[model samples]
Target: MPATVTKTWKLFIGGAFPRTESGRTIKAVAGGTVHHLCKASRKDLRDAVESARAAQVKWAASTAYLRGQVLHRLAEMMQARHGEFVDAIRATARITPRKARDEVDAAIEHVVCFAGWTDKIAIVLGSQNPVAGPFYTFSGIEPTGVVAVLAPDASPLLGALALACPALAAGNAVVLVASERHPIPALVLAEAFATSDLPGGVCNVLTGDHGELAPAMAGHRDIDAIVAAASGKRATALKEGVAENMKRVQVVDPDSDFTDARWRSPAVFRGVTECKTVWMPAMA
Candidate 1:
């Protein structure tokens, strides 16, 4: 008897299944066999950005509390699907089941922790400044609009979504380019987001032609920020590419304490970026 295909997941764009306009497909392998096809195309990216732009205004206007609520719901979803996520990790990252489950747990906890910071980060990272005169001056942390993330290829399942949540909780629309060779987990993430009330393109995940698409994302004008992890000569290339648009780039130091749970603590670095202020009494 032949196997029955009950369902096939499609690219999530504009909250609908608009297959790749270019009709491109990439294969994913497991246990030395190809078992899945992921879609990709230039038009798919365009449609994703369009979906993100459409919801950007309302999403940005929504209060931090509301955004946090959605994030909390996402955490709940992750916990329920823990096994599915671990399977993805074990296959892609080639980790033992025990280690894979640990990574999955870390990913989920990272989301739950980051979500809680949504309402309190600004208060903690934000501050009031002292001016020369009665003119009041203050700075509150704000989202950088649309963010694009190129997840670390080495730690696909855990590292990918780990970065995605922080960007979303900060009120930015994110388009993640998943690992090229390993994509099952990325697709699973897409399914999670689709049902999580993330409002479509807010968290679009595309897998294919990453070497070509990632550099383009850094240069695209619509991408306001990027958080990528890289090392070796490839890391150098990523820096050079992102320079094209001067996107707010953050290069994760490979040898740094990021792997340490302390550095991973939400209150430590999730939304703690700094900003400089200049005042000359309004140029007199």
Candidate 2:
């Protein structure tokens, strides 16, 4: 008889998988089997921020159409591995197979839906300003650099995909903290991100204690914004920490259903972008 090899999960940073610098691990027991995942520390968060910052420039420079294509590719990859996600979600959360399948379906659809908005966000969110001068003034949207995403605990895969897809579509790089309670699904999703056309660091995933890591993400100087899908004390802590940097923070209602059609719109893209106005003198 051959001995079974259990895989150890690592942090996905800058397109590479690295063990936590803290050398800490967390145990995840599912179906009488134990899985170990890296316990990311403050140093890991800092490194992810740096990597995201470096990648954001290029990602933002890409054409909106190109970004949309990349997102679409991600959706395709996720759909191809649909079964794996369902199993992962089922195992970690101990949810019914039907519910797990629904989550995976919603997640795939969420990515595809967001992909369609990548090229249209500027049109929907930006406009020409009427100024009292002979000038062409227009307002446009730009990525808010690196963003920190705190995935919700209730629906790990769906919540993480819901938050991350729009941010990436809006041209911002993200450092996503997977659900501390159910991170296996997120780990599987990271594999999809790697195989997709997403650039390295554009969507990094870390599994660890959210209570310990959420503040690090919020207070980091390099992080430009946060999409926090947390509630109660965790949500309060994240919001308060971002106050010091005045970073743009959007707190998702933890009770809200991430699979709702309303969440799949262009609205999520607006949260991770900054408005820029350009004025050009009209030909006289």
Clash count per candidate: 0, 0
Give all TM-scores, in the order shown. Answer: 0.85, 0.96
109-222, model 1: which lDDT tens digit per residue? Answer: 777777787887677777678876855567766677777676766557667766666677777787777766666676677777777777866787777676666566656767
Candidate 1: where is the Cα deviation over 4 Å?
Answer: 1-9, 232-234, 241-243, 253-259, 262-284
Q: Across residues 161-267, which tens digit of lDDT does each residue of candidate 2 receive? A: 88888789888999999988899889988888899989998989899998898778777878888998778887888788667788888989866798787787767
- The TM-score that candidate 2 achieves is 0.96
Model 1: pairs clashing at backbone N, Cα or C within 3 Å:
none
lDDT top scorer: 2
- RMSD of every candidate to native, in Å, equals 3.6, 1.4
| Best model number under TM-score | 2
Error of 2 at 247 (Å): 0.7
